[model samples]
Target: MTTLMTVLGIAVFAVGLLISIAWHELGHLSTAKLFGIRVPQYMVGFGPTVFSRKKGDTEYGVKAIPMGGYIRMIGMFPPGDDGRITARASSPFRSMIEDARSAAFEELQPGDEERLFYTRKPWKRVIVMFAGPFMNLVLAVLLFLGVLMGFGIRAQTTTVGSVSDCVISQSAASAGKTACGKGDPASPAKKAGLRAGDRITGFDGRPVTDWDTLQNDIRRTTGPATITVDRRGGDVTLNADLIRNQVAKSDGHGGYVDGQYVSAGFLGFTPAAGIVKQGFGDSVGQMGSMVHATVGSLVNLPERIPALWRSAFDGAPRQPDSPMGVVGAARVGGEVFSLDIPPEQRIATMLMLVAGFNLSLFLFNMLPLLPLDGGHIAGALWEAVKRNLARVFRRPDPGPFDVAKMMPVAYVVAGIFLSFTVLVLIADVVNPVKIT
Candidate 1:
């Protein structure tokens, strides 16, 4: 049954991935057609076509490889400096440029001269190229908001799960010693008669519905504070003298790690965790936090390659913060499905994973490098700048920037990306990350 669940989860994730790829391509296809640019093919994968249908001027298809997708726009690059598509050259670099230009004009039909992608205004071209990543961004935002506001997130609530016997740091609690040593005083919660199942209503006369807010209120207070709890259908009030104690602080990446201790008012009660629906503002804030973390992870990717190599072949344990490829993510989805939790929780977690994947796609595609949507957008912007400068100086128009000239650079970037992807894939298979 567990194996079946894992397979089902992976299959579901694969479907979502294909849908995301199709959605991404649809953005480009729609925008290109809207601008009268002829898109010959709208493919949802990279390999041989598995299914296809022709409609209007576009051939929509799904390919065998489900990794990525693209829409082939006619005349993606402008003609060469001589105002005509050039033949292959002896120089490898020049041949690369010419080959790209030739492919762009391969499916050129009658009246396609005006329908070429490069013939469109720079702003329109930008929109056409930017639409793909923007679609991903939109999908990510919707999924994130849906999961956060609709399904809610697992978080600590104000209800007390357990009360400590005595005051002790978290580190000490983790060392197999539950009881406080001699000379240690009873915990404030225990001394104040706080017990499990008591739902805290207020701290220091400040009403707090959530554990985080209540925790912050408690941390900031140093003296005696009035604690109101809903106990057995009645409000019970108690006064607890808070003391400055060492406590663990948030490490800011979702999980708490060993870090500098801070002096805060300690309340020695563990809050019960529950699913809590967040407000729109809170959801947006969480999305922003995810975006920040994702960007940081991408920026640190290069620094992690060495660790990935070690884990792939040297039997090193995978770091908790190690980067995950699509395979790792799918495996995680499978694990999530096979967890001993409620079905709703599993669905929510899976949706969150897909949302995070889409967000990563949006961010990754927006990088201003060749073979990416951002690269074409950058080229269009450069062309616009050059033309505007020429107009201001009463000089001859520079025309559209020849993005084909960057074919060599694009090839290099693609090669590096492929190498990194393969490395991550190997690491994922060898030292897969465990949720626990």
Candidate 2:
């Protein structure tokens, strides 16, 4: 039964991935058709074609990349003097001034076939280019809404669950100085001192009603500080020595930075099962905030690098954090699925995750850099401005932008992609986030 469940999970994952890609591409196809742009080819994936069929004016094919797909519109690049498809010299379809006309879906069969992508207006072309990312955003929103409308979401409370003993080293509770003795030995904690079942009242005067709150205070003091625990009768103050231990800094999606660690004062406290649910609106807002915060971190990564680099690689002050790649992401996904919640709640959680992922893809692709929807949008706008100026000066419109010029951006994007691929490979080795 476990093996059967595994196969089913894999199958579902594959199907969902493909469906998302197709939906994204459909946005472009639909917009192109709406504007009378000839879409000669629509494909999903990146490598050799596994399946293909021709219908009406377009040939649809699936590639092996399994990551994403594209809608090929001819005439998207600048017109070259090399003369391929010309301006309606005699025919609108077979113009010689065309060699895959810029922003134009002009790639007809080697024989003589006609589809008109170049004739579309500038605004229309812009819409077509933007549609793919827009679709991804829409898909994410739908998934989020579906999940929330189905199984409800809740905010984690500061409530304690169970107390743990023989604490493992990591985070605050793991420090050598912080790990409490099996029983309350006459050690530093017992001396300075502390006892089991002591409800930590505060740290540095900050009220600590729960373990997490106490942790936050401990992590803030990496060296030494005072901890006040509310005993059965009164508050007992003791000095705590903080220690640093390697802990997984989760990147929302199960990805984490392993070797590096966060430090906190250990209290040998754990929790037992009991949680408080947040309001509906607050729950939704929390999810939104999570997505925004994570994406913001990724976007601001450029500024966070040098310091982070020195810490991780160079023996400089220390490293901030590094990114986890695909492997890390997958491990997180598996872990989330592994949680022993009801099937409906599990499904909702998974869908919520996919929705967040798609949202990131949509926003990231729209970043006006090269090799993205924003780049294409920029190209189209530039061409529009150039054409308008030419007309004002009594010269011919410059037509569409050149794709060759955009190759540099594409190369850079390719390099970025390759770097992430390496990260993914390394992530598998560093700390694979496992389910159960």
Candidate 3:
């Protein structure tokens, strides 16, 4: 029964993934059709078709892989000189091809010849290219709004839920002592004079509303010295010295694992953080704050990427509880589905996650590479500006150039995507992102 339920949960997540991919592709398809561009094939997934159907002019199908979807526009690639599109358009054995490329331009039935995508206005073409990311953005915003208006939001309070079993060593603990030796605090925590039971209310004037805020802020601390606490509701301030936390965790083997740690100047004080409910009108505020937090994370990616890469490539294996991936997401989803959370809260949580997923999709897709919505948007903008500039100088309007001309960019995009996939797979195998 447990196995079956787990399988079912994965299926649900796969469905959601399909919906996200389809919604992104649908944005392009609908907008293209609105402008009368020909869409020869519309497909979900990649690789050979497991299922398919032929519509009026388009062949609709599902591919073997469940990662994403695409709509193949006629003459989309290779300045038309690549000859693949033209040859395919001219191929005699088109129908012999599998469904993955089966409905491509060359394979379209005779009646479907009139609506080639290139015939559309440049503006429409541009819109078609951008619609996917646009849809992703819309999805994200609604997700935020839904959680806010429907179930309300929660804000973090300074009160600790429970201190973690793992103390941040060197965090105001006594030197040469593993456990705050003689109460003479070791390094950073001791130098800063931080103590337990002190509630940190501010850091460098940034209000520490809750544990989440505090931790996230701490990661952002660079070349900093200062700590403020609201000990028993009384304000206490001290200069914080930078210190590192090196935790020696168990390898689960007979031997201990050497844990190289990351940290800032800790005042030795720690508190468990949690989400407490916010008021009705404040749900909107909750959305805004959460977004702010996420955006901050994104901005910090350049630095964080190094840590992630080191963790991945280092000789030591990564711990499973480190971060998240599909496995973790599925676990969370399954737990929610089985939870006793009130309907509103449950729904809100689910929406928030989905929204985050969609938002991440949007950000990732906008990376300005081929095969992604961002890549096309980037290409279209380049072409539009170049052509329009030439036109203003009285040069004859050039005919549509083949996007296939951008083949190099396309390959680079493919490589990046492949790397990301590999990273995710590695993370899944090692960390598993389990909710529990």
Candidate 4:
């Protein structure tokens, strides 16, 4: 049964992956058509076509490989400086440029002269290229908001789960030294008679509904305070002398890291965690944190390649923060499904994973490098800048920047990306990250 569930999870994730790819291509196709650009083929994969249907002027199809997709827009590049498509070249780099130009004009119909992508205004071209990544971004935000506001997330509540027996510093407690020392004193919560399952209602005469606020208030107050609790259908009040102690505070990224401590009033009670719906503001804030973390991860990717290589070949354990390819993500989805968790929780987690994937897609594609949407946008913006500068100086308008000239650079970038992808794939298979 567990194996079946894992397979089912993988199948579901595969479907979602295909849908995301299709959706991404649809953004390009729709925007290109809207701008009167002739997109000859709208493909959802890179390899040979498995299924296709020619409708109107475009051939829509699904390919065998499900990794990525594209829309072949006519005349992606403007003509050469001579105002005509350049002929074949002898040099390898020149051949790459000519090949790109040929592909851009291969399906150019007679009337496509006006419908070419490069003929459109710079702003329109920007929109056409930006639409794909923007779609992924929108999907990510919607999914994140849906999960956060609708299904809620697992978080600590005001109800007490455990009370510490003795006052221990945060660093000491983290090091598996929880036992009371000879000179240690009882924790404030324990000394105040707080017990498990007691739902904290008020702190220091102020009503508290959530754990964060209650925790902050407790940390700030250093003197005696009234603690109101709802226990056994009765309101109970107790006086507790708060003590100044070292505690681990939030690092603002949903985690508490070492060396980030503060001197605060310690309650020494662990809050019970449960699924709690978040407000729109809180959801947005969480999304911002996720974006920040994702960007940091991408920035640190080069520094992590050595570790990844070691894990792939040296039998080293996979780091939790290690980068994952599609295979790793699908394996994680399978693990999430096979976990001994409630169905709703599993579904929510799976959705969150997909949402994070989409967010990463958006961020990854937005890098201003060739073969990506952001690269084209950058080209168009550069062209606009050049033309505007020419106009300011009372000079001839430098026509659309010949983005085709950057074919060599684009090839190098693509090769590096492919190499990195293969490395991640090998690492993912060899040292797959465990859910635990």
Q: Pick the candidate with the highest TM-score.
A: 4
The sequence of per-residue lDDT tens digits that candidate 1 reaches over residues 376-416 is 99999999999999999999998889999999999999999
Clashes found in each candidate (C-alpha, N, C closer than 3 A): 0, 37, 11, 0
Worst 10 residues of 2 by lDDT: 93-102
Tens digits of per-residue lDDT for model 4 on 90-133?
A: 99998888889878999677888899999999999999999998
Candidate numbers sorted by lDDT from highest down = 4, 1, 3, 2
Error of 1 at 135 (Å): 0.7
Best by lDDT: 4
For every model shown, what is its TM-score relative to the native structure?
0.95, 0.61, 0.62, 0.97
How much lDDT does each candidate structure score? 0.89, 0.61, 0.62, 0.90
Which scores better on TM-score, 1 or 2? Answer: 1
TM-score of 4: 0.97
> For each candidate, C-alpha RMSD in Å?
1.8, 9.6, 9.6, 1.3
For candidate 2, lDDT tens digit of each residue in 145-240?
Answer: 666555656432233333444445554443345645666333223334555556567777677654445555654555566777667768678886
Candidate 4: clashing pairs of residues:
none
lDDT of 2: 0.61
* lDDT (tens digit, per residue) of candidate 3 on 362-416: 7777777776777767766776777898889989766665555455556666886
